[model samples]
Target: MRWFWIDHFVEFETGRTAAAVKNVSLAEEHLHDHFLGFAVMPSSLVIEGLAQTGGLLVGEHYQFNERVVLAKVSRASFHFMARPGDSLTYQATMQDINENGAMVAGTSHMGDRLQAEIDLVFAHLPSRENDERELFDPADFLAMLRLLRLYDVGRQSDGSPLTIPAHLLQAEQAMEAATDLN
Candidate 1:
């Protein structure tokens, strides 16, 4: 969670597919040190962007109740390096999801050109909290979703605005209260 590769989610469907975007810019520090005088978005960060898209798509099915983690990368291939000013769009489709884990196929594109394709595996871990808080605080997660404009524009398959679950809203309210006290 230290770095967010994706800038925002352009499309989100509960358990099916999601699309997100990331714009490579000259302002990013990592781009500078990656290679002296030659800046390109790192392949690893591109993979992470795809993983985030896939992981969120899979996790939404459980209502964010499970701790989802990237378990493995079955395959990842990039056709070309992305340079500054390039906008990358990532798409992930769910292959199959069950109680234990899920598999997803993701692809990235710069305009009409394919930049990368990835086959990923994700695992659901036993729930664990940090500092008496959930592994990922629902409030923080919701905030992230808001920042990504997911809730503002996300829609269900039937074309209804995606509503925030009651449990998550309650958790967010509690978090706000806790923060108020400190």
Candidate 2:
């Protein structure tokens, strides 16, 4: 999915915490169907935004080599409605990390109002012995990292432009083709 929340990292410290921001705009298409007059951002997408930010943090910490996905949400709560013209700040802190998985606690705030809180767990898939070089290029990883503004984590030693992997590029192309066909 295209990132619903195009977040930019404001603060990041590897193995510790990270903060990102997403500005809500009335021009966003989802707002049209969300509510008639009151275009409050959907809670599911808010959680997704937080998860994507948090997932990027964890993935970058591990050098984007492992196949990581959101395994579970331990706890999630929403307090206030996120409306258009609001800028949401999402902050996530690592609770624990291991070779197999990691946990993070995250909170989203709209100015002084708490919008949502979540505890997320992520699972890592190890590379197989003979899996076509694992299909993870450092350049592609770096590009995704940069796109997510996660390269500021002090872990990227080489500052190089990221390259998209051929496999992923092909998959995306196929998806586009299918959409066109449909």
Candidate 3:
């Protein structure tokens, strides 16, 4: 929730796949300290970007109702270092998904060259009547989706524009009403 490894979603297909981009810039503080003179985007951050892209895709499948958490990284292989000024494209494909969790296969590329390949598993937290903890604020999550341009590029299997889930919209409206009351 604090650090967004991916800049935005460039492509998103409901219950299928998603692609995101991250522009590596010299202005990033983390890269500056990563090395004295050699600044490269860390592989860990790259994995995070892939996880985020895949996680969002999986979460959207269930209308953002499930608490999809990255459970494991089954595999990862880095081919080359991504330097500043490189635009990394992360693509995540749904390998398998169910009520319990989902599996995602991901790849990172700089232009046509493969930068990394990773496999991830996401676990959906159990919903309980007694438990009311929310992974994210509905308003904030909606805003994030908007900022990421998910709706701008996302599409359903039938090729229609991805509609915002009713639950998310209602929650956003409720938050707005509460804010107005304050």
Compute the lDDT for candidate 2. 0.75
lDDT of 1 by residue, 11-89 (tens): 9987888999999999999999998899999999999999999998888878777778999999999999999999999
User: Model 2: which residue pairs collide?
Assistant: none
Winner by lDDT between candidate 2 and candidate 1? 1
Most accurate candidate by TM-score: 3
What lDDT score is found at residue 24 in candidate 1?
Answer: 96
Error of 1 at 53 (Å): 0.8
Q: What is the TM-score of each candidate against the true structure?
A: 0.91, 0.76, 0.96
For all candidates in order, the CA lDDT equals 0.89, 0.75, 0.95
RMSD of 2: 6.5
* Candidate 1 lDDT (Cα, 0 to 1): 0.89
Q: List the lowest-lDDT window of 10 residues for candidate 3.
A: 1-10
Better of 2 and 3 by TM-score: 3
Task: Name the candidate, 1 or 3, with the larger lDDT value.
Answer: 3
